[model samples]
Target chain A: MDEGSAALVAAGLGKRYRRGWALRGCAVAVPRGRIAALVGPNGAGKSTLMALATGLLRPTEGTVAVRGKPGFLAQGKPLYQGFTVEEVLHAGRALNPDWDDAYARRLVAEAEVPLGARIRTLSGGQRTRVALAVALGRRPEVLLLDEPLADLDPLARQEVMGALLAEVAEQGTTVLLSSHVIADLDGICDHLLLLSGGRVQLAGDVEELLAEHRLLIGPRELDVPAAAVVERRETGRQSTVLVRGLEPPDDAQAHEPTLEELALGYLRAGRTSGREVAA
Target chain B: MTWVAWRQQRLLTLVSLALVALVGAGMAALWADLSSVLPADPAVLDERYGDLLGYVPFVMLAMPVLLGMFAGAPVFAREFEQGTHVFGLTQSIGRTRWWATKLLVAGLPVTVAMALLGLLNAKALGPLSSILTSRLQTPMFESQGYVLGAYTAVAFALGATAGLVVRSTLGAMAITLAGYVGVLAAVANLGRPHYAGTEYSASGAVEPGAWRVEIGYLDAQGATTTFAGQKCGETPIAQCLLDQGVAGRFARYHPVSQFWEFQGAESGIVVLVVGVLVAVSAWAVRRVH
Candidate 1:
């Protein structure tokens, strides 16, 4: 495997269904060993891209390349309902030729999931842990996790992310996980890809992306360059505009936008564009 | 991949085989006890076995559909319903290997068991040939030979294909049952008779176990008699036949001795259907979301 190569690269990726395209012209690359977040609203092609990258679904018009074998924790963390946790791990071992049994066992042990318990018997948190263990068992160079924290409570979500981060840190594996909520991933993900309307709306180093955008507070009737504003909101007293890669105008007070504000701005921008296309 | 697929279907496959084994045990006992009542004619058969004659073949006929619905319908359908196919297909294995291994692992045991079961049923019912009508005939033919196994394979394939297409276990099972019955009806009525050339007999003494395809009188000129001519519906039909100058009753039939030939032919047709189903399923698996 090429250690310096991007963990995953998609070029002009497009996926079509019976009625319409789910994803189109998608292109992004996450550098090796980065914790990348795929942020989007529901039905923004986040899951579609994840599915394509993991090879579960093929692209209708492009290609996805993974530097090495990828391990996927699919949406809902689907373990065979009838299988015990041990059997699920056994299935992981059987399916993956390069399975790391020790790592798989340690993950389950650390999470306190009982080996003999059926998958359906486990609660949401426990099931997520077991599913993650199965994916990690393959010792893949890149791990694609789709909605790993969707069903967990806030505390459980923190714990699951903590566990996931701890493992990825130790192994130095690249990971790309998808989520609709920005607050959950605001701190953990250093690389970000925001998707909407089957395209990449924003993608880059999270810190860099944040630093490039500023929230400008100006008068409600203030005039500004349309090209400079990523998104805007107006009130009777004031207008708040998200400006990208620019200084505030002469009369406005500029403030650094929080990661959530930045992400929300981009997500809304993408959705508006998507609706325009649909209309 | 094979192990994973086998594990998924293990319990159902074993249970289905156990059901076949149970049937085999009873049939074996029947075969063992069959010699005591042999060499008798049909008149004494009713006094001997009575309604038991009807019960055995009915069970035999139902086995393939039962096994097909139980074993085949849920293979892919349940995976999709539970969302486990996402896990299965995303593994390092190619979709084709996953689909093919599943088909083979899930299908092999029941097919071999049904074939063996059919052999047992045939052997068990052989001595009662006078009472069984003919192994080469309808309903009886389906129960007694290798075609039974082939029917099972076709039914199983139908079920498995339906699962992939419908993506629902209950839907697949319903399709399997309906498709199995439909295929059997179509083959018995339309496909079986064309397997080989039928033998023509000059007398009404067509051999027992031979399937009677058609029968008509042949006149002195050796032309087949038509219904529009001198009616045989008259009283004293023997005298009426003489008055009409009918020389013989010509019969077209599949002989009892052609049992293996018919088995090979019918089984081949159904197995071809099985092949098509498998190929379609293999293609459909890749297309599933």
Candidate 2:
């Protein structure tokens, strides 16, 4: 990818804690104006990547850079519990030179959050909305959100995502959103960057990537290229195989895989391969 | 950034100021009472204010560490606890500015207020110096004059820096308390007397407000000598001392004139320590996350 067209780019980015490397040999380029889903299992370094991109964590090796100003909604959406919503907005204005106070206040009003209420008194959904307002107040060109929907109920998740998508659409801001649940990001994201075991497992335009892969169901003895097979499951005499860049045999039924199917296949493959690599 | 920091620290700063104001008011009342009764007998002054002197030192000495633990420890530790530090750090402001603003906003008001209270304390206690023990001693020296503000600065710096290092409010508070007391004791015992030279008198006669550090015997040659005499059963103490070949008693002391000099020396050292703590805090903040 052209570096100028990428809003967030990392080449061989790695971060090591005292125990071991949390992320290593990772490379990803999030294209400008695209919402990229950063899907990974717990401890898969999804949060680590977002933090590095936001300049929160220094990479122990390699380079990571964000093109323009960036805003981050950290995991748990942390805000000052003692501060009222109005004061929280004031803090956003105080901390960011490019802050848009009116826009922030409008977002809060749209969320129906009272300006006088302290953060601790707000519901979880309300708190997330307030935090999103603060993050968006800076009018950042690139926004990184880590596990933003983890604690929300299904309805609040939809509302938050809807509100976030509306703003992104209006502003044309690039976003890299991390989540463990692939279902949450299935239809919203245009790009996919999957991480597992501190490395990028798969990264590409979601539609094109999904189109190139097929899920095949047939007899257990079905033939396919070993290199193209991502994951295979067998039940009695039947086989379900996920393959990339492969043609299906005449005996099998084939169809393009859903995003969840594609992600789960790669995650399972990564787990088995990670054990092999460890050995 | 300053506004944000001040908002976060508003409650603790106000509480600390209120505490200092309360103490100042009490001290002002005492100063008025003491000023009205000056030139009176020492016994009369002692009778009126002796009980107060016993507890004032403890209260005054405790104020700095209390402000440090309450105001300074939570400046960063509470942010870490609630995870708001990530929010603060990711903003447009740099980490150094964030650290500095928080430290200054939370630490300055209380430190200045304590300094004013210290001046008031000196005024209130100045008239009682002759009736009490030397003002250069532990609780007395520490409770009044410029050292109070200096001690407050050190405690506040220690608490703020410890919060960054430990990342827990209670842990930081414990460290601040322990570290403040440790520095206080170390300075008093090891650093105070050495601030200036001590005067030696062979007759054991010191000025009214001088601090007598040591007392020993002198021989005919005017050198310090150890007592080698046995216990006297019936003889007078002076006769027994003469028989034992003791010439005179000598005193090693710091005169009343050295009070301000000692204050300046101790405050200088404490200010230097505060500088080191602030530098560490700045370094630690950048290393966070």
Candidate 3:
């Protein structure tokens, strides 16, 4: 994608902590108006990338730029425990120059969260809703959510995602939502940016990425090009292989991979490559 | 930004101010009571108020650090602990503004309140200085002048800055206590005595309110000398000193009039430390994530 068309861009982005590099040499872009799913295993630099983009964590190297004001919902969905829901809205209004007070209140009402309720008194789902309201109130051009649904029940997860999608649709906002559970994002996200072991393992439109990869089941002795195999699993007599940009052998059964199959294949491939480098 | 910062810090600030006000009220009552007994005998004054004097200064000396630990340490540390700092920093209000606003909102009212109480303390305690230790001495010097305000400022700054650096409330409170005590002790022992030049009295007698730093014998030639009192045997120590070629006794002291000078010098040093802490806080806040 061209620079102007991308809502968020990172080129050679990296971050290092005392333990080691959390992320390194990452480059990706989410095009405007696309709901990008940042899928990765735990500690795969998902949070690091979001923080760097929001200017919370400074990059150790390279650059990350967002197109406009970015709203972020951190992994824990942190809000002031002492603040009332109303006060939280006040805080959002106080902190953001472009805060939409009425809209935030409306979101809170839709979630059925009491305006006078202290955040500490709220249920997990209520807290997440209030946090989401705060993030949405800023009318952000780009929204970066880090494990936003991690603590919610399945019902709350659906509600939160639905609310977020409705807002994004109306505003035409670009969103980069992170989660390790690929199923949560399967039907929602149009773009995919998968990370594993601190590197961008796969990034592109989801449909295109799914179309390019194939899942094959063949005999254990079946031969395939090593370079094309993303991941492979073997049973007593059958071998399941996920391959990218390759045709299947005549004797093997093949089909297009699901999003989970595609993400899991790349993540497993990235982990093995990391171990290889370590070795 | 200011409103949000104030709301977050409202409870701690109010509590700190209330504590200072309580102290101020006690000082006011004491001043009134002491005024009613003006011109009393030194012995009588000592008999009535000496025990209270011993405890009051210690309480006053402890107040600054207590406020630091409770009010200042958690300003940033609590936000970090609860993960709310990430929310604060990501807002449209820039990091510097957020930090400065919180520091000012949480720190200013209490510091000013302590300063006002300090003035009240000086007014109330002035009449009792002769019976107590010198106004230039510890506890007294620290508790009843603008130095009280300065000390509180430094403590608060130390705590707030430590919170930013350590990112833990308990850790920051511990640092604030240790750092405040170290600075206070260093200033009282090493800094106060040198604030102004000492005056020498050849007759070994200083004015009633003077802080006598040193006393020694003077030789016939007018140089400081030590007497061999053991060698004098049955001779009185005063006579033995004279016989050993000591002309008279000499005393080095800071006169009572220099109290304001000492207060200014100590307060200046403390204020400088506070400035450094504020600078450090600004730098540490930027590096928090």
Candidate 4:
């Protein structure tokens, strides 16, 4: 990847806690204007990575950089509990020199979140919208959201993602979004950065990543090249295999896997192999 | 940033000001009545304001601690507790500025008000000074003069700094209360009287409200000595004193006239504490991430 065009870059990035490393030797670069999804299981260091990118956390080793000012929507989308939606927006304007009040107001108005309603009084979905508005109000060059849809209902998640998509369309801002659940990111993210345990298992353009991998299904006796297999499962009479690289063995039926399967395959593979990002 | 800080701190600020206002109103009434009866006779002054004289200083002294706990302890603690620091710290405004702005915006108003209250208290408790409590002593000294505000600032600084370390409002509050009282006790009982030069009076009849740091006999050689009650026994004090062969009576005292000097001295110490706390807090803000 060209470092110059990358909106977010992490080189040998690591974060250590008392018990163990939350993330280590993780290197990733998402190009500008791309919606990158950071997929990982719980405790996979997705939050740690986002926190580091936004400078809310300092890395224990190596470096993470955002090319320009970053707007972060942390888990739970923390807003001042006592502040009204209006007051929160006012705070956004006060804190950010580039804050777009008109854009924020329009977003809230579109969501029908009452400006006078205190944040603690808002519903889960409404809070998410207000949070998104605050994040967007900064008119950030890059937006990093950690588990933005964790608490929202399906419809609300759709609405939230829709709003985010609109922001990206209008502003062309680079967004790096993280979620443990891959289904939530389906069709929305153009780039995928998959982490497991404390390492990045996969990082590349989603379309190209999916194209490079194939799933094989056949009898359990079929011999599969171990080097090509990213992840595999066998149950008596049938064997299912997710393999990387363009060529597939002629003995077994091969087909393209869904993005969910692609992500889950790497995730499961990373867990078992304990893969490190660089080596 | 100032606007955000003020809005976030608005509720605490209003509540603290209202508390000061309530205490101020009550003190104002007490002043009105006590001013009329004071200097007549100590007994008369006591009779008019005796009820308040017993407990008012206690309440007055507790105000700074209360301000520190309620206003200052939660300044950082609430943000961390509620996970809102992520929002504030990640803003375009630098974290140190955010920390400083909140400290000044939330802390300054209450501190200034408490100082003004201290002045009002000095006035109200003036004529009745030494009738019940010495204005130069511990609980009273802390509550009565310009140092009241200074003490509040120190308490606030203690709370704010502890909050940054402890990251919990309740824990910081407890720490502030206990730590504040401990510091105040050590300063008042052990350190304060020595700040201003104490005078050795040849006679024990020092001015009323003069804080007696040491009272005893002065030998011919002028060496100050303690009043050992052992020599007096249970006999009448005059006979006990006569039997003791006491020489010239002398007292090492901080005179009531030194009220301003002591206030300035103690206030300066408290302000120094505030300065250290602010600097430490600035350094602490950087380590938060």
Candidate 5:
């Protein structure tokens, strides 16, 4: 377990529920000081995989390792109901040998978490903030957060995201946060693990995903390269095509797509044709 | 970190202390009224004081059950119910450490409450032993049954285990109460030798008929009344005695009384039994996805 090289590593992770596999044979490698965003639709196992990686739930099969104590923020900000805000922070200090009490207090004070107030008395956003403070106080080498900004209001979302971004910048902690809120991940994450139907539909550096997968829009009458086209949506006069591999035929007069478009294309390709990422 | 755990459980500590206060106040008033109202003839007061002392133990039996339900049941149950355990399990502590800390933190206030009450009772009733020679002539200020101290620890541990298993505050509560009642009832009436199996006789054969414990109750008139029942409704061997005929009135004469009852072998067994349950509970919680 080299401190710099292996922030977190998962080999062939899987989780099976009574209904079916929530996550099936998943593998991921997170490097130190990098931010990875696990993006998937409602039931794509983003949270499940994060939980397994953090050791909150034992994998049905596979191995996961963290170089040091991993800080984990679950899918929802779960907290003791009757404890005062200060008391909740104390729990973090008591449990984590590497706790930074000053840092925890700073975050709480900045977030305006009333130290005397009970957790049950705090608003939902306030509770989430306190939870974030607790997680950050650990000064962990690896941080795993599931849906960190799922329920936050737009204003609070930015504030929370900014706080996280600041911590990552200062401490260089490897962070893996999952979100259906794609925009939240756009600027913060360097890596992406896009999943669907219990498998990784596409996963790699965000730059690689944008570079390799091209979304094309052109005339329906024009010749579309069969191999380049992975999925397409046609609407009478114009057509939108999602292409994988080399540049969308230089010969075809089509406009390149945005990251959102490429993501949608990857998902649409998986839905229509059973195309799955090799990794 | 230990401080944090103690702080988290401060409310329970306060509640336990409040209970001690109430018991203290109530005992003080009862003693003053008893000594002042009874005839100056020490003999007359002696004749009635023992039964009044009996109430102390009788009422105190419910303390363990109460503490077990309120404090122990919520130790882990509320965490699961609120999903807070996810934070606890993922933190730096091992599952064992987490539970051990909770038991320690939660046990403090209960011990303090019991100890303080014990001291007060001793101060108030120790002097009466010489004058109240009749077993039934103890003072109204007598200490409650010592078994309550052991029972409270056991019940609290058992309730915490139930809390971990049930994962819901209300559900844990219901299960804990039912378990306490069931175990106590089984111990009192069933006459079985063990929790899970029948005890074998020296003959190496299963015993024949169900064993019964007959309890004789002496009413205010001083006549004895008896009731008979199977020890545990199990195979024939007599089980642990839960309570005697007059709601444990004979505890003063019971062998456990000669020594400090709370420090007896039964106490050790209670602690061990609940401890095993708590360990199993931690393992079970780990398996919960």
Candidate 6:
């Protein structure tokens, strides 16, 4: 509720369903004007964390605060079937006291969401776009999107992501978007929070994550620093080692991993070790 | 609107209003007796129209329940089920604000509409009751009166509250309707008019021969004739009397001829209880998740 604080802050956040912890002891802080990606595998609690952060779900323990107004782009687009896009948008305008009509119109125009089209009649992707457009129109302080780019055609994804980045740039709006597609987060998000098994294994700047983690490929018997190996893949002649927080040994030939390779290594480690990885 | 509210449920609002109007018209037609065979005769039709007017109050009851089940239940539950509730929660509006907006948007309009319809329908149905039967003209049970208005408001609030608590359209509807019927039935059976004390006392208690008695008969023309009597408790049949200084033999009866008294008391009680239910629903929505 503190308006002057960071855009988002979570302390020891946890969500325990009847079955088990969907997300536990997760914490994240995102400042204003930055895009943060919640990157995780299926059932990794990315969506759960997003839900908790947005205040859709109460944390079993911990706190999530959005410094100011936030906009949520829900996983699935839901609009009144009988209402046209314009009507639905108008309803938002009526209901939301902070609604920015100009931004809404601009997003609507950019997304090409037909104003007269009934929401139900629009295609799935189009409906998703419309939902996003409405959220953007709100001129929110923080926009939390859950799988907004899922099932989008390449071009559609570009358009939506473009709009999202534009909002972040123009309004200095902080954004937290979840996606399984690493490529989608490549250039758009400056930060990444990788969750596995109901916890955050790693969260930091994309550049820092890339610089600290290394993927070393060499002979199976090649001398390698055991401590640097966060994860390792082995075959008869080739070995791939994912080194965590690597300081790059003085005459070492170890190559730092790309975000994708590092992510894959973390995923492989989670699969093989059966570890909770939250640490 | 705080939290992330949707304007999509306006469909339910429009649909509920239209359906209520149709049902009201149908009830008016069914209960509007235009013939002598109906009751008390068309010459005494004023009261018959009054009987027909009884249905007007039900509009308030039906509309609120309908809104509760259809509007409140789906407001937030559907988003969770569809995996899209996060869209609203992450917005500039906080979760509580979103919930407040949704309730205001969906509940107030429907309640206002019901109130207006109740007034208009009562006016239209007034004449119909008089033309149907003369006996139905009791002042206590007048259609669309303050008593009935209170009942309608409470009923609607209760229904909406149920929707918020239950969080599923079908679930809220089933529970609300069942609760409505059960509460009314229970209150009626528990609070019916009945004798609470003995009808007679002894000589010392009676203070020597002090007695007061009266007899009344309702004529076929619906007028009452009264006779004072010194013969108190003289006959167990056709008359009743009691001594002044002691507990006397007296008859007990309900003030209104039919069960109108019971209905009024029970309706008020039900409304009060339902009002509480609505308040709880609002609170539940405020903390929705």
Docking class of 2: high
Q: Write the per-residue lDDT of candidate 5 for residues B1-289, one digit (tens) a residue.
A: 4675676577887887788689888767766766665444556655756576555655555666788888888888777777877887888888767767877788756855765665555445443443433211211211333434556666777777788887877777787778776655544334212222223232222211222122234433444544355553653323322332322221112211222332244445555666777677767766755
**Candidate 6, what DockQ?**
0.31
Report the lDDT tens digits of candidate 5 across residue range A86-173: 8787788888888899998998898888899999898767888898889989887788889978888988888888888898789989
| iRMSD, all candidates | 1.1, 0.6, 0.7, 0.9, 1.8, 4.5
Off by over 4 Å in 4: A275-279, B218-244
lDDT of 4: 0.88
| lDDT tens readout by residue for model 2, A1-279 | 787799999999999888678888998899999999999899888998988888888999999999978989999999999999999999999999889999999999999999999999998899999999999999999999999999999999999999999999999999999999899999999999999888899999999999999999999999888999999999999999999998888989999999999999999989965544223
Which sections of candidate 2 miss by over 4 Å?
A: A275-279, B229-236
| Interface C-alpha root-mean-square deviation of candidate 1 | 1.1
Candidate 6 local lDDT, B17-128, one digit each (tens):
7875776576445445443334355455544444544554445445555555565556655655554444455545565666667666766666566555545545454334
For this target, which candidate reaches the highest DockQ against the unseen true structure?
Answer: 2
Model 3 DockQ reads 0.85
* TM-scores of the candidates in the order shown: 0.95, 0.98, 0.97, 0.95, 0.77, 0.73
Per-residue alpha-carbon lDDT of candidate 3 for residues A31-64, written as tens digits (9 for 90 to 100): 9999999998998889999999999999999999
TM-score of 6: 0.73
Question: Could you give candidate 6's per-residue lDDT for residues A51-151 as a string of tens digits?
Answer: 78766788899998888777887666555556688876776676577788877877777777779999779877788778877887777888888888887
Ranking by DockQ: 2, 3, 4, 1, 5, 6
**Which prediction has more favorable DockQ, 1 or 6?**
1
Which residue runs does candidate 6 get wrong by more than 4 Å?
A1-6, A245-254, A271-279, B1-155, B192-251, B257-264
Worst 10 residues of 5 chain B by lDDT: B248-257
Off by over 4 Å in 3: A276-279, B230-234
Question: Taking the true A–B contacts (Cα pairs closer than 8 Å), what share appears in each candidate?
Answer: 0.70, 0.93, 0.75, 0.85, 0.93, 0.40
Q: Across residues A1-279, which tens digit of lDDT does each residue of candidate 4 receive?
A: 898899999999999887778889999999999999999889888998998998888999999999987899999898999999999999999999989999999999999999999999999999999999999888888999999999989999999999899888788899999997789898999999998888888999999998998998888887877888888889889999999894777778998888899998888878755644322
Clashing pairs in 4: none
